[model samples]
Target: MIITSAKLFEEILAILKDEDNIFVIGCNVCAAKLRTGGEPEVLEMCRRLEESGKHVVGWTLPTAACSIRSFESLVEKNEKINEAFCILVMGCGSGVSSVANVAEVPVYGSNDTLSLGGSSGGKLLSEQCVMCGNCTIGEFGGLCPKAQCPKGLLNGPCGGAVDGKCEVARVNDCVWTLIYERLKKIKRLDLLYVIHAPQEHGFK
Candidate 1:
């Protein structure tokens, strides 16, 4: 899932300093799961804005704010959205961009978009992928070195790998070591002999 966190209230206030009539939009999916955006978040933001003496023209919680079609449908249903002087998006970067693409008024983000992550534990999200386009997890026994290794190394337990731990991030296990162990357990140790080419860089 795409992780997100609310932007500081001070930062949001600064961005909306010149605007009065604000429309808030939230995502019902990823952002909601992260507690950064959703119906409750949208209502809370509206309350905050109103308490600050700013007008909240309307608010919406789109099923998937990042989806163009979903955003379009929201816009169609929320006529008050057009009455606002500006829009505050309480979702990820993608959701903000989606709203900006079709919004008549200027769009501003109220959340900081973070990496692709999954729940590591209760209310804790840990990044799992960097979306490098070229996936090589199969060779590494499904472990992503790009995400697990601090250096984003493709072929390594770098020279700094020690005692199955990463030298850069001393607390975490070396991803390469995990990969090696997993491969050994699966009897696919020969795959380690195969050298992977450098990842091709550029837009996917």
Candidate 2:
């Protein structure tokens, strides 16, 4: 899931200082699950924006604002969007981009997406994938070194792990140590010897 956190109220207010009429939009999928941009969040934001002296034109919550087809239908039904001089998107960056793609008015994001993460325990998620485009989880028994390792080491441990704990984050287990144990468990320890190419980032 896409993990995100709501921007500070002061930061949001500062961004919208000169703006007046605002149409609020939220996501009902990942952002909703993360509580960054859900129905309650949208309502709270609308109330807060109004309290801050901005005229909130209207608000809509689309189930997965990242889905182009689905969001278009939501947009079609929300006529209040036309009255907005600007849009405040209470979702991830992708959601903001999706709104911007269809919206003529200036669009803004109210949250910052952290990482591609998941949660087993309620409301507690951790980064599992760095979204590097080329996934190599199969080699490391499904554990991503780039995501878990503080140094983003792809090959193996940096000889910094002590007693299975990471040198960088002492509280966390060394990702390579975890990978080694997991690979050993699956009888695929041979994969560790193989060299991985450097990551090709989308941005410089």
Candidate 3:
């Protein structure tokens, strides 16, 4: 899931400073899971806008605000959206961009997209992937050093690793240590000798 956090109230107010009639759009998938751009959030935003003396024309919770097709469909069905001078999207960056691409009025985001993460527990989000366009977990026993390691080391732990903990972030376990333990447990230590070429920096 794409993790997100609501933008500061003051920041949102500044963005809508010139706009009186506002329409809100929220995502029902990732953002909803994060509780940043869900139905309740949209309603709360409406209340806040009304409190600020701005007229909220309407609000919608689309199935997937990041999906252009879903957003376009919602816009087609909601003619009342046209009454608003601008739109406030309470989803990720992709969702905000999707709305801006198809909306005639100006569109602004009310949330800041953080990372590709999974729900750890409650409101805690754990980042799981960096989308590096390469998959090397098969050889590393499913632990991604690129994402887990602060240095994005692919081969092994940096010299700074201490006592099975990452040097960059002492609170986190050293990804290379985890990788070595897993490989040893599975009798795949031989794979460690195989050196990988540097990742291609260009587009995949």
Candidate 4:
């Protein structure tokens, strides 16, 4: 998901202030969950921009703006989408790139996609999955040491483990403990005794 900042939004507004007609396109899939560009967000932005005296030509949210096929259909149905002087994209960086590929008009951004993470609570989420391709959970009892460990260490217990809890947060469960349970369930508890050496993994 992408992260949006107030400064970024102000800068975007400054750029489009001169334009009369503008289109604010949002993505419903990842961007929505990420709190970046969903349909509701696009509408809120439209209202604010209209208040600023810019004419909002049209606004719509696509299921997955990054997909070429989905965006193609959205563009076909929303003919007035291109009628605007500029387009503001509310998806990740890939969405902006895809929109630019299919349109000749100027494109803008409404958020910054940092990394993939899930929601923690109401209007709040955190970076849990770092998207490190080299996964050792299968060998580590399926507990994802990279994500569960407080230090994200590949080796066994770190100094941060305190009384079976992580030093970072007392409420947080130990990653190794989770690993042990998962390993035991799969009859691979013996694998926990073996230490895994860190190795570089490259993205495809």
Candidate 5:
């Protein structure tokens, strides 16, 4: 899942200041799960737009905005979409771009994509993928230390974890500890002996 946070309402208003007729779009999957671009949020956006003197011609929700085809299919069916002068995407950056790529009107995002991550027990987890480009996750039992660790420890835990909790973010589990447990469960503890080269920063 892609972690996202809503943009300030004032920022959104400013972005749409020159546009009078608007069409709102939301994502039903990642953005919905995070409550950043869900049905309720989309409706709230429409209400706010109308209150601000913008005409909301239509609104639609696609399952996953990153999946361009799914968004395109739903967008093609919206009758009132053509009436809008611009589009407000209550989803990630990719979703906003997806609308821009497929739609004829201008598209803008109302949410900021933070990171690639997952959740546990109905709560957001610390686990994430930074897309560093260099591949080393296989050595850590499918977990990337470059992403999950605050210090981005590649060899092992920094030995600062207390009771399996991270030293930097005490509420989160130590990622290296999680890696070790995963390796042990998979009978790949020998991977700990493998020294990894430094990640190439050229991708940035």
Candidate 6:
């Protein structure tokens, strides 16, 4: 799912101002987990818009924003939303598109579409994997050295590997150390002794 921010709020407000009846729709699945949109955010925005004299017809949160199956529940619950001049989407791009597809109404996004990721903590979106379509774990012993290492080191610990921690960031565990441990666990530590010669400058 895509991420969203407050910058997209302006675009949403601009499109929704003239609309008399508005339905603020939130998604409980990806959008909720990512802290971008959910019931709380939807209700808050609904109240604010209603206070500003806009006729906020109603609000609803579908369990799965991308699933049209659960969207049936929205019809039974939020019948007033049909009166809405426009539907406000408090979810990612996919969720917004899905809602628009099912509702058959004008959908306005309340958030910007960012890359796919997960939240490690409260509102902290950490990019764990890049999905580069390339694998290099054979040389690195199964650990993602490119992502976990301080400097994305692949060959070995650079000028930094102090006491099994990264020299660049003391709090970070050295990727080489993880690789070494993994190799030892699999009885492949002997592979570490194999020297890797520097490559020539030729394009080949």
TM-score per model over all chains: 0.86, 0.89, 0.86, 0.73, 0.85, 0.62
Using TM-score as the measure, which candidate wins?
2
Q: Candidates 1 and 4: which is better by lDDT?
A: 1
Runs with alpha carbons beyond 4 Å of true place in candidate 5:
70-75, 120-123, 202-204
The digit string of per-residue lDDT tens for model 3 on 1-204 reads 888999988899998999988999989999898889999999999999899988999988888888867445866757668788899999999999998888888999999887787765565545567787867768778777777888877777787888998898999888889889999999999978888777777313
**Tens-digit per-residue lDDT, 1-204, candidate 5:** 888999999999999889978999899998999999999999999999899888999998887777667444855758788788898988888888887888887889999888888887887853478877767678799888888888877886999999999999898889999999999999999999998776666423
Off by over 4 Å in 3: 70-72, 120-125, 185-187, 202-204
Query: Sorted on lDDT, highest at the top, how do the candidates line up?
Result: 2, 5, 1, 3, 4, 6
Q: Mind giving the per-residue lDDT tens digits that candidate 6 earns over 71-118?
A: 466777788877877888888777778888777667887877665555
| Per-candidate RMSD, Å | 2.5, 2.4, 2.5, 4.0, 2.6, 6.1
Task: Specify the highest-lDDT model's number.
Answer: 2
Query: lDDT per prediction?
Result: 0.84, 0.88, 0.84, 0.72, 0.85, 0.71
Assess the local accuracy of residue 200 in candidate 1 as a C-alpha lDDT between 0 and 100.
Answer: 57
Model 6 accuracy (lDDT, Cα): 0.71
Clashes of 3: 0
Candidate 2 lDDT over 1-34, as tens digits, reads 8999999988999999999899999899988988
Residue 120, candidate 1: Cα error in Å is 7.0
TM-score, cand. 3: 0.86
Candidate scoring better on lDDT of 3 and 6: 3
lDDT of 1 by residue, 99-132 (tens): 8888778999999887888875575545678887
* Residue 10, candidate 5: C-alpha displacement in angstroms: 2.2
Rank order by TM-score, top first?
A: 2, 1, 3, 5, 4, 6
Clashing pairs in 4: 2-113, 3-112
